[model samples]
Target chain A: MSSERGRGGKARNWLRLFSRKSPPTAPAKGKRDATPDAKEARAAREARRAQANAKKASRPAKTMLATPAADGRHRICVIGSSHMVAYKLAADETTIDPRLFVHFQGLAGREFAAIEADADGIFVDYEKLLLSPRHLRPMWDPLTDAIAYDAFDSFVVVGTLRTSHILKAFYEWRTTGHFSRAYIEAGVEMLIKRDPGVNLGQAIHQASGKPVVTLAAPLTAIAVDVGDQAAMDEAYRETKAAIEKGFHARGLTTVFQPDETVLDASSTKEIYARASQTLAGVEHEDEERAHMNAAFGKLVLPDILAAAGAQQAETGAPRLTSA
Target chain B: MKNPYQSLPERAFWRPSVSEVEPTAISDVYRPKFPVDKSMRVVTQGSCFSQHIGRQFVTRGYQWFEAETPFTHFPAQLSRAYNYGVFSFRTGNIYTPRLLLQWLRWACGRDEAPDEAWTNREGSVDPFRPAIEPDGFASDEEMLASRNGMIARMRESLPSIDLFIFTFGLTEAWENKESGVVYPMCPGTAGGTFDPDKHVFRNYTFLECHRDMTEAVEILRSFNPAMKILFTVSPVPLTATATGEHVLTANTRSKSLLRTLAATLSEEHDFVDYFPSFEFIIQPPFKAMFYDGNLRTVTKEGVAFVMSHFFKAHGAADETDGDDAPRRRTVTEAENDDLVCEEVMLEGAAAR
Candidate 1:
C-alpha cells in the first residue's frame, strides 16, 4: 500500500530521542579516593582500564567508510523490518549531497514478511500483515501501494538476517572446533537463505534487475561493559563477516555495521543505545538490548546511503568495507 | 511323551506364529543379546534404513550419539538437506560392507582417502559421498576438507560409542579398477563419469561381504572394546541393477545375500546381533504392506513396525505409537520416508 506523505517537511517523530532512557552513569570518584576500600577499588579499576587500553591499541585502526561521489543524482528506497525506524530517525538528521534522494517504507519485522514481489513491482499484502501491540506504528506513506520497479535507482534492504539471531551458531562453531570453517560458513549461508528479508531482497533484485543492498541487523548490547570481552567481540565480528560474505555470494550488495558504534567486541556502544525504542516508538526496557535507538541508526545511515550510491555507480569496485 | 519339538515356544512353530496372528501383530521376531537403554551412547551407520533407526533413538529419548553435527543454528531441514543428523555421521548411505570398511580405514588413519574428485558445471563432488552436499562443493579442496573433517569426527566419536548399528543396504557397487575402491553408487549416476575400462560393476559375494563387515567390526572394537554391534538388512528393493538380470530378481538375490551375511555374522560374533527388519517387510505374511505404491521406498508404517520391535526388545516404551504420536511430529513421515540415497539417482538415468 502506498500513500503520498509529501516531501520537504520535518516529520513530527524526528525528535523522538527525548523519551530515551539515559545510559548508566560512571561511578563517583572524589570522596571514595581516600578510603581503604575505595583505594583497592581504584587500583582494580585502573588495572581494568589499562587492560582495555591495551586491547584498543592492539586492534587495527578503524577504517572510515567511503561516501558517494557528489556528481551524480540517485534515488534510493530503503525498505525492511522494524530496523527502518532507526534509519528514519537517522536519515532526517543527516545532511546529504544535494544529488541524492532517499525514501523510507516498511512494517515491523514479522509483518514485513507480508511484502511480496511480482512482475509489476514490490507491494505489501495488507491482509497478511498482522501487527502486534508492540509493532503498531505508522510506516512511511508512499504514493502507491506498489513500489514501481522504475521508481528508484536502487534499494536498501535493512534488518534481515540479524547477526544476533545466528550468534549461537557462530559460538558453537568457535567452541566445538570440530567442523571446518567452510562447513560452518555454509551452514550460516543456509540459515541466511531462509530469512524472509533476504528472500525479499533477492526477489526484488531478480524481478527489477536493479541493485539491492542489504544491511544486517547490528549486535545487541551486552549486560556489562567490564571484562576481557575481546573473545566475544571477535566472535561477533567473525559472525558478521560470515553474514556479509553470505549475502554477497547471493549477489546482494552488503554493508557492515558502522565500526564506531560497536563496542565490547560484540555489542553496539551504550551511547547509541541510550534511548533505543522498539518499532512501536515505545521506550525499550532496561533489559532490552536487541533494538537500538536513533543514535545507532544515525551512525549507520550514511554507510547505507553510500552503499546504495555504489550500486547506482556500478563501478565494479569491491563494496565490502569495515571500520 | 515329551519331545523337543512339542516343548518349543509358539514362535518356533510356523502355523502359530504366522498363521494364527495378524501381520502387524507378529511377535517374538527379534531377541537382542544385550540390553539397550537411554544411557548407552548409540552410533548408527550403513544404509538409508539405518537413518530411521538413529532418528527413532533420539526421539524415544535414547542416547543416539551424533559424532558429527552441523552448526547449532542450522535449521533441522537445512541440516537434513546437507545430510547432517540423518545418520550418526554425514556419510550419505554407506550402502555396502565394502564402503563401510573404506570409511573405517580412512577414519582410523589406516589409509588415506584418494585425492580424486568428480567435476561438473557446478563444482567438485567427493567420490565417497557425492550427494553429501546438495550443491556441489566450491572446489576439490573444499570437498576434501569437508570429508577429512567428517572422518576426523568419526575417529573421535568411535572410541566413546557404546553401540554401533550398521544396516546392510546393497550387494552391488562400482569400483575403481586400480585402487579397488568402491563407490556408494555408480560413478556417472551421481557425479563422476562411468568408463567401461576404468569403472567396473561388482556384485559382492557372500564371503566378500562377510570379510568386509568383519574387518569393519574389528576396527570399531580396536577403538572401543566394549562397543556392541547391531546389524539389519535394508528391505528397500534395488532401484536399478547394473547387472543384466531383471531388477526384481537382482533385488531378491542382493537382499538374500545380505540377509544371509547378517545371520552368519551375528551367529559368529558374540558382540554382534541381527534384527529381522528385512523379514518384517519382505516376508509373504506381511504382504508387502510396509512398501509405498512404488514398492521401493519403505512407508512410515514399516519404519514404525521395525522400530517398535527394536524398542520392545530393549524394553523401552515406543512413544511413536498411540497418543504421543501427535506431539512427536518433529520427524515427519515425509522426512522419514525420503531417504538420501545415491542408488535412487540411477532411476533418473534409466529414464533416459
Candidate 2:
C-alpha cells in the first residue's frame, strides 16, 4: 500500500500479491477498471520489460508485480468447461473492449475447485496437471499469471448449461427419440438446477475480488433429432431465461445468447453447429455434433462484449433516479 | 366425587386443557371438522405469527400452496426478501379480519381499490403492504400491476385451497376516511405521509370483526365450497397501542376481543374452527415460557407448542418427533417480523 511505483524489494513480491487474494471486505466504488483487455495487454507488455530489467540486475522478475497501478483497462480472466473453447474462438474473431485482454483458461465443466476462497488464487496449477493434449498448457498459464498479480478486473465462467448439452438432449432424435415433451422439459429444468455456472461465478467473484460474468453454454441444434424439435426449443429458451435470472439474483453478469443462433424454435441452423475447421483447416476436438464452429463463435462474441459492458456500467453506476 | 364437575371431560377445564400436561404434550386443539391431509392445497395468510404455520408445512411435507413463485432461478433468500413464495401468495401479512375481507372482496371482484400508492424518501410502496418490496415499487403503475398480479394469483389459487389458516394479529387499524377501508400499517410507518385529518384510527369491534370475517368466509366458500378456514389469534401482544391505554391493558383487550370473536364464529359454524394459540402463550401453567426476552414476541418453544397441538389434532404432528429445530430462526422471523406492524414504527419514533 505504500507506493504504486517501482519497488526495489524482491523476495516477497509473491507474498504481497498473494495477500491481495483476501476477500474484498468492502466493495468500494471505482476500485476496479470498467474495461480490462487493453490494460492487461499493457500490463503484460510492461511486465516483460520489467522482467528484462530485473534479469539485467540479477533480481527475480516476480518483483515486477509488487507495486500496483490503481487504474487502467482491466486484466480480464476466464476459466470454464469445453464451452470456453468457443469463447476463446469468439474473442479472437470479434473486436473486444480495446482496454481489456482476456487471459482465459479452459477446464472441463466437471472440474470443481474453490478458487475464490483459496489464499493462492490459482484454481488449478497447470504445471502439476497431466492432460491428453499438452496444448492446453498454454491456455492454463495465462490464468495463473493473471491471478499471481491479483490482476483480474473481471472473471467469466462458462459451464454445463451449454447449448451443446441442450442439442444432445432435445435437438437430436438419436438421444431423445423416446423422450416426451414433458420429460424433455423436466430434463432441462434438472440441468438448470444442477448447472454449475452460477455457483462458479459466485465463488470466483468472492475469491477473485472481481465482478463475474456467467456464460450459459450456447445453444446449437442437434441436427440428428428431427423427430420433434418444438420441445427442445422450449427447453432451451426456458433454460436460458432461468440461467440469466439466477445470475442476476447473485449479482453476477450473464452473456446473452447470440442472435440468429436458433433457426427455429426446435433447431439450431446446420451451418452454426457443423464441425468447424480451424484456420489451418483442422478439426478442433472430438467430432461432437453439439459443438458450434468458429463462424457461430463469431456470432456469440457480442454476448461476451455485452457482459463486459454491463460489468463496466455497474462499477461506474449512474445513481439511478426513481420516477 | 359425584358432582356435575366430575362428569365433564378433562379437556373442558384449564387443569387438563393445558396444566397437568407437559407444554409439548398438549394436543387435539385443532380437530378438523373434515378430513385434511398432507395433500391438501393449503393457503396461509395472516399476521407475522402465522409464518410459523407456513414454515412447518414445508418440513411436514404438506403442499403449502405457493400461487406466486418468483422465477425459479432466483436465489432462495433473495426470493424470500421480495416476499415471493414466502407465503401462499404475496398479500404480505393480513393483520386484521377486515383486511382479509378487503383482500377477499377484491380477489372475488366484488370491490376495487382506489388507484392509490405511497412514496417517500426510499421509494413508492404498495398501498396495502408497503414493506413487501425493499425499496418500494418504482412507479405507481408498477405497484398497481403487482397488486393486480397478487389478486389474479388468489383468483387462481382459491379454487384449490382446501385449508386456509389465518391468524389475526391486531384489532386496531387506521382507516382511510373516504374509502372506509382499513390499512395493515399506518401510512407513514413504511412509506407515505402521515396526516391527522386523512387518517383516522379505528378499533374494530366484535360485531364488525364477526361481520367482516363471516363475509370473507362466505366469499371464499362461494368460490370453492369445500374450502375450510382455520383461525388462530396471534399470541404476540400489541407492540404498542394507539388507543391511549397502557400497553399491558391494550394487549389484553385486543387479544380478548379477537379470541372471543373467533370462538363465537367457530361455535356457530362447522366449517370454521378456532385454535387456542392465544391462551397457549399467555395463560398460566405455561407462564409465558414460549416468549422471547421482550415478554411479547413468542419464542421458538411457544410456536412449537402451539404447532404441536395443532398438527396432533389434525393427525400429523405424531410423525414429527417434534424436535425443537431452529431452522425457522431467520432475520425475517426474529427482527424483521416487526416490519409488518405500524406500531413498531411508533415505538421506534418514540425511542428516537
Listed in order, the DockQ scores are 0.21, 0.05
Q: After superposition, how far is residue A271 of candidate 1 from its true place, in Å?
A: 4.5
- The residue-by-residue lDDT of candidate 2 on A175-257, one tens digit each, is 32322233334445555555666666766666566677887766545544544566666555665665666677677878765
Q: In model 1, what is the error at residue B308, expressed in angstroms?
A: 1.7
True contacts kept of each: 0.38, 0.00
Residue B339 local lDDT, model 1: 70
Please, what's the RMSD in Å of model 2? 13.6
* Model 2 docking tier (incorrect/acceptable/medium/high): incorrect
Could you tell me the TM-score of chain A in candidate 2?
0.57
* Candidate 1, residue A92: lDDT: 55
Cα error of candidate 2 at position B148, Å: 2.2
Fnat of candidate 2, please? 0.00
Error of 2 at A274 (Å): 6.2
Ten-residue segment with the worst summed lDDT in candidate 1 chain B?
B322-331
How far is each candidate from the true structure, as Cα RMSD in Å? 17.3, 13.6
